[model samples]
Target chain A: MRLEPIANPGLARSAGLPAAAIALTVVVASLLALLAGADPLATLGLILKGAAGSKFALLETLNRATPLIFTGLAVAVAFRAKLWNIGAEAQLYAGALLTVLVGTQLGLPGPVALPLMALAAILAGALTLLGPVLLKTRLGVDEVVTTLLLNFIMLLFISMLLEGPLKDPLGMGWPKSEALPRDARLPRIVDGLRLHWGFGLALICALGTWVIQTRTTLGYEIRATGLNLQGARFAGIPVNAVMVKTALISGGLAALAGFSEVAGLKGNLTLDISPGFGYTGIIVAMLAMLNPLGVVVSAIFVAGIFVGADSMSRAAEVPTYIADILLATALLFMVLAIMLTRFRVVRG
Target chain B: MDLIDILLSASFWAAVIRIASPLIFATMGELICERAGVLNLGIEGIMVAGAFAGWVAVYAGLPLWWGVAVAMLVGMAFGLVHGVLTVPFGLSQHVVGLGITMLATAAAYYAYRIALPEVTTPPRIEPFQPLDMGWLTDIPVVGQALFGQTALTYLALLVALATGLVLYRTPLGLALRAAGENPSAVEAQGLSVTGIRIGAVVVGSGLMAVGGAFLTMSAFSSFFFEMVNGRGWICIALVVFGAWAPGKAVLGALLFAGFDALQIRLQQTGLGAVVPYQVFLMVPYILSILALVLMSRRAEVPAALMTPYNRGER
Candidate 1:
């Protein structure tokens, strides 16, 4: 089962399995589209151009990328401790809900209201992660199931809130919450685009996560446990604490993503607030090889594809699902590639 | 309808049966796969694919039975893909399975969008009618609940019994168990671990396909995007509750189905209950985590559950 590995870490290291697989995926996806009568090269060109060709397109890409940065860092942080926190979607929603509830309900001044709302949102997300973390570390239950199942429950809760508790009275019958006070809104950075301070917050979080992951005592213990649990235990690293802490941080970061969406863009929570940012974060983390800084870069790359998908849908008469297909293909290749990076292959 | 009247109605039982039926098929399929030491995480995808393929076939003028058969075939193909990815490719099973689920979901959506015009409403077929046992109608609640269900509902229960017999009483079951529990020892005894597991997954896929087809053809009567919902993941939890036993898994599925049925029923009653529906919606997952935590302490995992088998190693 040992796969081929390239020992050289340099950029010039000639084609490895990861490279080959990624190239294969791009080729295969293009060929598949080409078979459907669309020109492969042209479609790719359209995708690239649609995402980054214009001043507006670049802003659109960054705007789409904002939530991903937070969630990607969320996933990467927890993954470092080998605690798979898959409930980022729920956490994000819960955070958004709390943020909206606070923003709309409390009419505090600009300075105090924003920080309190952000704090409340973070706590809401962290609270959601508590259930899974407790089940995993205390009861030895699999967090994967708990986190995933919680996602549905959280979605249902979100739906219920929009439909019942928080329904806007002014709207014609659509399911959405009341808009937040103007004072609570994040100042927009772009003149004519939706890009705002949330992207900056995500960037800051990524930087913070990078520092925590590479330069802290807790980070050392977390990585130790992830690399080798038994060895970590033998070395007196508190695995349980590290796992819990990682899950909490993961949940908090995801919640902040929710907060950003509410504060920066919408000013109120709505149904379908997230377009699967939480799920996409997993792909982003893996694509980055679980590096925090890499998550920021990969998030931007993925955001470009997403932005591109919308254009492809309008112009090429192709479904926007190509983003998912490409990502899946990239994931498969990257996983194979990353594994190869770890071990060398030879004839038995 | 009055409270007692609603409780005693045939339609109420029918609704319960409809909800329970698909979970039964899927949970049993999951039981077999987990018992064989391969947790096929692609069940969600396979089920959705089956639902779409089954509905499309029926919509395109195929017989109902043939549509179900096509669903099973597609499921097997998906299972084969999963098997090759996990068994041969040696990828992380969870990651591969997750990727497959995402890919299948996206593919299913695109397929639906492409096949049908955006403005056109999707087609729906007449759902399979429940079998009415004319003589057994005299038997009150038992007759209404058991004798008046869809063919798939009965099949699900019968399959559970059949799976139990095969897994617990047959020599084939013993060999399969040995393969999962200790693949190297099974290999030493001249058994093919890969073959047994692949077979298990393929069969499991077929069972899961039936579950999906049941969702479309029997329960809802049409395929929709994200139709399988979270049922596939629920089956993963059910596998733990079942302790890798078919009978136990079926029981767990029934419990979840009952909870689900009750949730819907309660919502419809307009009882104005104080408890949030979301909390109740979380019942299955919450119960599963609680059950797993309790059972895993006392229960046993297959010796080689998550480990990839290397033919010549050890």
Candidate 2:
């Protein structure tokens, strides 16, 4: 079998293939449930019900998706420029560390403190990624391995800080940071709602990212650079400058995930603030095909699976790791499906 | 003890060799894949799966060697999936690799939970014992460091030597290297590039699994979550550090493991009290980055690495 390029794929093929990918993921998930001796249909139902069956569940998912949206957007932006920033986890931690530092140390008013915390977080994250990006641009190193290695390095740095200078004085022997001041905490979206303003910020950022990608000069440059670096260079585009700019934006966006998690949901920063949100962002970005608005939708979908699976595990014998397996399957299948949309498989 | 005294101790050298064993296996594995023009980022998860597969197989009464075989087969299965997507499908290697890692890791964890539901602590098995070299073991620090190790450690060193010999001496090695450097040339010779690439990935990934098995079967007696840690990623760095050569990669692995051994020992010294334990833990990762930066200017990466080759495209 060989693949032949399609001249133009219709809307049905484009839409149907991704839908079928999701369907395939569901089928795989069902097989896993069967392996565990649980009823597949009931297990899936439990997941969906636990994810959005009630107001609390929906709010929980929204809160979880909040960080995902930030990280997903981060990955989407970096990948669009072909920068290959796998250190979103490190960037997120950078943001979280700054948030904790400023939120706890500074005694400014809410209006002054909140924005300052975010700015510091963004700067920290952007700088965290800038190191690897510079290494790539100057030394001709591959960003993928450098970025990945930085994640481990960043976590160790965080651990050191937590155990040393940043340790909470009030907490008994636990390695955690001090809680953010009440004024620094993000207010709920609605007075009675459990959701924080981070979700609202995520939506705004997604819309803003979409606008930037579709209606800006920088976006076009990024796309061109990604498509053909030598061609873009021949066309007079500053390729290295574009990469640096993309890194700053991507790092800043990922850092926001850490900020929101600390200042919005969790009051204090800990080593486990992110349960692989940075890594999961790659899945979200790939599933969205690097589309910013699609990242929002995909982040919510991914978060729902995690939240749902967590709740479902309590009720059924199936482990929550099923969520990871399902998403991974979806990501692989979706990429293949997307490819099939533009290429037709033919028997030679 | 002081630094000189610590370096002179037989125990320190033994730890260095022991730590280097798994890394040598995984580095050689990664070296093969990169040499064949495929970057198998699934190394970490593949290692995890191998650790679990090998340990569980032994726990279930399989012979230790059979357990290693089971781990290799499991690694190859994941490798096949990765090879299919990245090769024939022409998908992004980065995306497919990370996807494979996530899938493999989750599947391993899920299977473990299902297999042992009630155990809080991971169960242990009788791991490989050190071979007795009689008087060879009596020869100062060098003796224990080189000869007083499990069969797997010797196998790791042998694998590294074999990799170097095969890559430099064999016809198959020439074709494999050509696949990475110039696949069109390989195709011109009436060889199927796809088959060669897929085979390299399969075999390379099998070696990576054995590296992981070395953890459970030799280094430790039990399998646990996150046992592979970031060792797989470190091996990728080692490949670059070694400039994609098997002998140099083995040296890189030894250098890295030496740093690791020193850090562990340093933690017990007076310096350990002055510095945070996390600082010592950070040394290997930092060294990896430094190694990359230092080698970046000199290293000759496979010309066609990460590039998907489509017949008749040009």
Candidate 3:
């Protein structure tokens, strides 16, 4: 059997498949809602209304999606370079720790402190990810395994800090860091809402990623390397260096997610902040077909589903995990839809 | 307590065996799958599914052994899902694997919550108890630790050794290995590489389910949301650390289990206060990374790993 993509699978037709997949996912999710004893149409209406029905919902949705954009971009960068950096979650934690540790200790003005926190977070994410990168590049260690395991190690490392030295002495015994001072917390973009300046940073990061991926030498090397590692090596492209740099950038991007959450929203570190954004980012990257710009749109879509589902659960008897089912179903359909676009399957 | 006091105690060795049991099964399962070139990153999710399925079955008044069967069957079904997606479609292995993990885990958690609405005070059943070793349990320091273990623990040891033998000594194993190493060669020899690879994946998934069953049926004997945690990931690492050899994989699992058991003891002994217990928990994961670095130089990856076997395509 062989697959030959029909010559120039028309742009519209190519685009049509993903749209069809979205429909398929919605139908499946509706059936699931029906099983949970809810009217599918009503459930869908509830989700839509809860997601963006009002002014407050819009801000909340964007705020929720802010971290996802960073993590999704993190996953996109590494995946596009054919580097599997599954440690993004841990790298996010590393950034969170640095945001608190550096902010409290340095005591710089807001402008200097914010940039310093961002830089420290980026460096922290990159350096923390260096272990897996070296093992992967130098020794051929499976990054999937190493990076994944490093998440566990990172979780333990951060938990140690949060519970031991960094524990807030006055937060009634909860294991979280002291709140960031006014100088350190990210400035708010709106009054009476949690929206913060990190939203702007996230937008800029997405734009920067788009420009880099589509219009630069490094981007060319990365895309080429992802397309064909052997060919890239043969073409005198530094595949190893590209992989390392992508890994660093990927880690930095993920770290910024932590920075956004802590500095922009929480103003303190806690274990409950991220709900698997690092892992979900993979789905976002795949949904966008690894396009940097598409990541922003997909990230927001995922966030909307989750946040809406939370409100839906509060309003109805349905559980919130139904969103997980919807998301996973959508991903499977997306992959199948993509494969269909790329290949004309023949009987084996 | 001192290092000797920790290592020499019967409780220490028992904890090691108890902890190593689930990993031994998972690592051996991974060894076979990787050897056959399937690279089922879905193993983690499948194990979680198995744990939930087994627990639900036993809770519903089925025989304990029946629950084990339920686990294996559920795992095989997922193995089929993974095989169809990766083997035929040639989708990204990591993407499919990660997606399966998320879906299966979420489904399991949902089922647990929905099935048992009394989440505040959950029901419990009597889990399998350790076997009686009689005189064997009476032996000085090693007696209780080595002999007084659950039946699953001993089965895990036997499975590890059996896997090593089957991998090295059997004809089917040869076909599986050949399929992974050079599928084109195997296909030319009038053999179905795809069939062998799919068979490998299904069988590996079944064993992994049993490993999951061990967690619910023997280790903790209760289903928790995050029970499997990262053990599946650890098993993946153990396979690499042991260079894809089942016997060595068992040893690697034991090493990790020993570290895990030791940390618990050190923590309880108040030494954990000196260094936060969370830091001590990092020891096993960190040590495994070091082991991977040391072992990767001699690692023997299957040539066709993560590659779909497209029939008649160069």
Q: Could you tell me how far off, in angstroms, the CA of residue B234 lies in candidate 3 after the best superposition?
A: 0.8
Report clash pairs, candidate 1.
Answer: none
Between candidates 1 and 3, the one scoring higher on DockQ is: 3
**Candidate achieving the largest DockQ:** 2
Score each candidate by Cα lDDT.
0.81, 0.93, 0.85
lDDT of 3 by residue, B201-293 (tens): 888887887888888988876888778878888898898888787878888998899999988888877676677788787888888778888
Docking class of 1: medium
Q: List the DockQ of the predictions in order.
A: 0.55, 0.81, 0.67
Isolated chain B TM-score per model: 0.92, 0.99, 0.96
Query: Which residue pairs collide in model 2, if any?
Result: none
List, residue by residue over B220-302, the lDDT tens digit for candidate 1: 78788778988888888888887788777777777767667666666556563766666666666667666777776766677
How do the predictions measure up, each by TM-score?
Answer: 0.93, 0.99, 0.96
Give a tens-digit lDDT track for model 3, residues A189-282: 8777768988889989999998989999999999999999999999999999998889888999999999999999999999977888888888
Question: Candidate 2, residues B127-235: lDDT per residue as tens digits?
Answer: 9998999999878878899889999999999999999999999999999999999999998998877888888889999999999999999999998888887899999
**Local error of candidate 2 at residue A150 (angstroms):** 1.0
CAPRI tier for the interface of model 3? medium
**TM-score between candidate 3 and the true structure:** 0.96
